[model samples]
Target: MNSNSDVTSRTVTALGPQLRRRKSIKHMVGEAESNSGQLRRTLGMWQLTMISVGATMGTGILVILGAAVPIAGPAIWISFVIAGVTALLSAVSYAEMAGMVPVSGSSYSYSYATMGEGIAWICGWCLVLEYAVSVAAVAVGAGEYVNQTLRTFNMELPVSLAGGPAEGGVVNLPALIVVVLATLLLVRGARESAIVNTVVVIIKAGILVFFSIVAFSAFNAGNFEPLLPMGAAGVTAAASSVFFSYIGFDAASTAGEEAKNPKRDLPRAIMLSMLIVTITYVLVAVSAIGAREWTWFVGTEAALVQIVGELTGQPIFVLIFALASVLAIASVVLTVLYGQTRILMSMSRDGLVPAVFGKVSKRTGTPVAGTLITGIVVAITAGFIPLGALADATSIGTLFAFALVGVSVMYLRKRQPQAPRTFRVPLYPITPILGIFACLFLMSQLGWHTWVVFLIWMLVGIVIYLGYGRRRSRLGQLSKQDYIASHVGENQ
Candidate 1:
């Protein structure tokens, strides 16, 4: 009996540190506000809402129909609803987490405070893939639309300079152009970036409204006749793919630290932005299909512009539509690129990544070094890689992260029942459970190649965490006494 108790004591001691390894919610929020890691809190609810709207509304709407229409035919509107609802459920969970945690790490921070370091690292890794590759994907779409605009003036770049290597061009110089425009805005500061994004968002939203009006005039109810042409399975599969269109609703959560009233505004921003994005997506998808045959959408570039152009037969309208798309897509690159840097900054603060990524400039109050590095990297990606291979990869990564966020919400609600939250997920467990199920089902619909790529990326993240992050972790280095003190009321 003595020997068994001693053996059990030793085992417990060995596992103690691992058990206490999760970063306390207090410590994580404090670290965000610390002088060394602080970001300027200039954003109000409107700016935060715009960031989410700008990020979520642009990339997928501009390009996804061309790819998704063939898969689901006229029923693509249902796919949009499926994707939007999946995103809405997760967005609600993110809102609850944002109010309770209120940090720049978004889902990563939520995972850390609720789950543990291992889970948090996995979430962060998916975020890196989600944001960076998405920037590239959005930029590629912007480049093509920019090309459309140039053609109206008969000044389009030669094919060698205009297209990605996949399209037989040496480099997609126009993609690089849009990335640079966004990079310049971001490096300046979040306030200015938000201002410009708000302006561009309004312009693009107007252009979309105009497109809807014109499309309705040419509405062909016949186009929607075979609404379930491909059946329910097809709608679900296309929902899995088109879910990429709803990826940016959590952009507001990433701005938690930068919000003037993070606990109050973050939740509001997330919910409001999600509402706007869902309505816009459904409206646009319905309008587009009503105006044209689903068959014509396949292989068409700038699907919306084509619809408006064919409907109106006006060169000036095509020019206007193309310009708005360029702005819209650039805003997405800007907001997502902003979210990407902030995630790394939070991770670096926890000593998971390089310190350079965590550094905030005194003048601009943004992560200057991180912004520049991210810009250069994403620019190169947009310049070279074809957009087709990039799209599914982003959706898979995002879905994985979102499912974990839903899990995090459930974990926290049970673990810290007393924690204050400005916003609570409606219907509690059911919403989150549905969110998790929705994400998993959508993820199941993804192509096997996307799964392979995602698995490889996760493998790389594991290697990095084991080899470097585990040793350098700020949380791991904390003394047990200090850790307990830091935890304070989190466990209660």
Candidate 2:
């Protein structure tokens, strides 16, 4: 009995540090405010809303519509609603969390505080894939559209100089150029990026509206003959793709720390931006299909520009549409790239990734190192890899992140009922539960190859966590009270 007791005590003592590791809500928030070398809180509600709009309305609307329309015919509009609703549900939960926490990591920090370090790491990992790869994907789309715009001027580059080999281009220099430009914008500061994003958003919105009016003039009811040409399965499958457009509303929440009034503005920006984007998407979808048969859009390089060109036979309109696409896609890349570095900065602050990612430049108040690293990786992916099915892969990663965020909201509600909340998710558990189910349903519609890749990526995250992050986690290094006390001491 004595021998057994001794062994048990030894084991318990050995496991104490690991077992006691806790990333509490308060500690996480304090770490963000005091220790992260925080970002400047310069963004107003409108600027924040524009970030969401700019990020959400880009490549998916401009490019994916060409690919998604044939799958659901004219009924691709319904898929937009379905995807939009799912995104809104998740956004509601995100709004509540963003209001209450108002931190930089977005869902990753929420998960860390509500769940545990392990789940938080996974969430952060998923976001890295979602933001970085989505940026790369959008960059490629932007490059293609820029090339199209140049062609209108009869200044077309060789296919070899335009894109990767898969897209029949050797290097995709234009895509690389846009990524580098976006990187420079981000490294300068978030406020400057937001200013540029706002201007881009206005220009893109104006062009989209103009095209919609023209498209409606040429609208033919014949395009509606068979709305569900590919059936319900096809609509749902396309919803899984269209869901990409909805992904960026959450980018607003990622800027919680930088919001001048996060508790008030973050939630408002989230819901408002999503509303604007949903309306814009519906108008564009209706106009595109009504103006031309859905079949006409399939496989087209610049579908919207082609629609406008076909409608008016005007090279000027094609030029305008092409310019809008380039601006819109560049803004998406900027916003998402900004969001990516912030997540990585948060992860680095928590010691889940390299310390270099955590370092914020005093002059710019930005994560310069992480921004450069992300920019280089995104540029390479856009320059070399053909984005065949990667958009679907990115959609899956985003859905997984959304599901976890919904789960985090519910978890926090139950675990910290007394925690101060500036906003609450509507309908309690139903909203969050629906958000989770919707994400899972959409995720199920993704192809098996996407799932395999996602699994492999997650497995790699686990290996990295175990090897480096698990022991090195900042939360592991400090006791909960110690962290709180340190912050209190600093304030005093």
Candidate 3:
């Protein structure tokens, strides 16, 4: 057994270096030379952290909890813990990978360098699920808050203008409008976008804290009766649903190419943002459940506002928080739309997607065309689809991307063991293995319809990869077979 194990280790040691031939580590000091790169690297550790915070801390906290509470009952906070623990497992793995493969594509770039181009393309397509679809889902939540705030003035946004077709409306104009607003901000450039996001992140994080404190004041011990009303399966199912809330925690990794210090900052921001989100989410969920009966959460679009209004009976307070939710949700749209375009840009650079998606305007140093196009598509989807369906789809995509990132990390650990990493997963293979299992377990808890949608999306991705990406992949000359043939005997 020892002799056989020794031979296996020797073969792996010989093959590892040959397998890892791809892009150089992308940590330019401060910023890339103006002539060297397209995207500007003006984002600091604070800005990068806020991007993750702003993007993930939105609609999930403000709106989705209302939907999740009924499923998990008063123990909804436990669902958050279930999901956050799963996310933490993946977040640490992401931190390790981001530190090593600090680039714009996030999981997609990491996969390409570790798993090969085909898997990388699939990862990027899944990212469209995570970033693009979540943008639309979160925008729908923002539209609800918009209508709720307008109602305070005795003016209501008509369903045709503010609600999705699934809700018996023609088009969700507020949803479209919100996406347009975020898109415009993204077109202004990354630095300006980051600054705006930082401000909103601080404001919204504060708003959540304010909500938790106020909720505790109204807390009733009776609300805690029968914590798991539907049983443990229900909490797991609700966790699957609320996993959508953690969707954009990887937004920091997507900005790896634009960070002032990608290696150090990317890992720090990824870990920090997820920690903040998990702690806040659990606190907020527990506080909310303590304040309101779980069954009353159903069909609530403005849950946080409703909770505050019921507790204080003050129209002004409700109005302020509702307006704050609008600003808060808009930040999610801004940061997520930014992440979506950057992922497309990275894929474009790799020839998996079109060059137009990768184009950066010299004036703005941003992907203007790509951002506009992404916003338009997301807007149209947001206008037609309901939040519940979109949220589930986004969760599946997120879990899929996260699972692959876990795989990517484990793969790199074996394939490039000596790679320079500013951070490492705390438990190495065990952490990544658990991350993958946790993501898959949660995904299984989702409804079958979500799986069907994911399959259809994968079919489309496969066809595109076969017709386009497989032919034009920029990693063409460095084909695995060609490299092996050239180096095998010589190295031996």
Candidate 4:
């Protein structure tokens, strides 16, 4: 049997010169400041957990119930369970990796340490798609809810400023406004983002709990009698649609660098947030199902608000629901925007993306340039694209990234047995394998157009890698250094 020392030696030697060069470049690129400006380390386990919940629970639970219910009927509850379990598995995988690496880049940095450069670039690209597009989708959803809320007071924005291009509008000014506000908050630092997120999360949760209580009073047992009206396949399909709600679990992982004790805190945050979200979802699903027959849920936008209005017989409930939706969706945009900028910063550090992305503002100690660029792209997407289309596309990209992270955990266990890990996936091979399969299952249920768009995005990433990233990569340089170092040591 190989001794521990032997394993350590092999691991170090296997790092190769390319890794060293990459490390050197990362150090150089990250030299701007050790302090992340005024970003306070005030976030504890509770705050981090809430941040995850804030980011995940928004438009998904409040808005998506309508879309998903039509597909699976009362079995939408089962869809929530299925999606929750699958997401938990992947969240555990993320916890382990984030604990081990404890960096700002989330999956991108984890892949860099375990899977090498080319794979890391692909992971980073996928993350950009996942975070930026999801933010845009959430922003668009927020705009709709805001517009709906305003109309209740007899005030209305022009269609061009409220709706997307697909809905007979040239641009969505409200959506662009949402992205810009989130960007400004994020540029200030993590502490401000956390404070704002915490407040928004509380508001959103209170509204949901209120809805659940009020709607439950009107529950009719007969409403759920034909629970599986669409069968098990329908439940599975609905679960796939519901999986979008779970995409933000990775949001906590992106804060690895700012986390007080990353290894200990990350796992707690991921698991706790997921568990809370699952419970919240179950409550909302039960209330929605019990309030009315499953079929009535079809074709409704902002379905939770509709459920509330039906139960209370008051338009005031709709106004409150819309307000809750705005706060929740805005929180999602902020968290995801912060995540995308960090991933870009990591890629820039590795020389896989333009160095400008890696630049830290001396005053802010944040990746201001990357944040601005990401915000601009998301604003444009939200301004022109419909929420439904963007949601599907975001889900595909997110599932792909989740699948990669799960696979990476298993791969790293075999390839880097000696790497330090503060937390391990409880079931090891089984956990990660299940996570990979679950992600694939969800991806399979998405429309073919989503798959086509995802492929095109990946192709674009590959092209950029070949044209620029490959030549400038610090990984290649590090490998060369390791080879030379080994030979020199041998000669001596």
Candidate 1: residue 269 lDDT (0-100): 93
Whose lDDT is greatest here?
1
TM-score against native, each model: 0.95, 0.93, 0.91, 0.90
Pitting candidate 1 against candidate 3, the one with the higher lDDT is 1
Candidate 3 Cα outliers beyond 4 Å, as residue runs? 1-36, 385-391, 477-492
Ranking by TM-score: 1, 2, 3, 4
Ranking by lDDT: 1, 2, 3, 4
Could you tell me the lDDT of residue 59 within candidate 3? Answer: 89
Ten-residue segment with the worst summed lDDT in candidate 1? 6-15
Question: How far is each candidate from the true structure, as Cα RMSD in Å?
Answer: 4.6, 4.9, 7.2, 6.4
- Let me know the TM-score candidate 4 reaches against the reference structure: 0.90
lDDT of 4: 0.79
Candidate 3: global Cα-lDDT? 0.82
Candidate 1: residue 420 Cα off by (Å): 1.0
In the range 1-492, model 2's lDDT, one tens digit per residue, is 255653443344323454334466666666657843558889999999998898898888888888899898889999999999999999999999998888889898887766667778888889988898888888887667877899898998788878898976798888888999999999999999999999999999898898899999999989977989899998999999899888778888888778889889999999999899999999999988899988887778678888788888989989888988888888999999989988888889877899999888899998899999989999999899876666568888889989988988887787677778888998989999999999999999999998988898899988998788876665665544564564452221
Query: How well is each residue in 324-391 modelled by candidate 4, as lDDT tens digits?
Result: 78888998898878888877877887678899887777677577888888888889889986666546
Which of the predicted structures, 3 or 4, would earn the higher lDDT when compared with the native? 3
TM-score, candidate 3, is 0.91
Predicted structure 2, TM vs. truth: 0.93
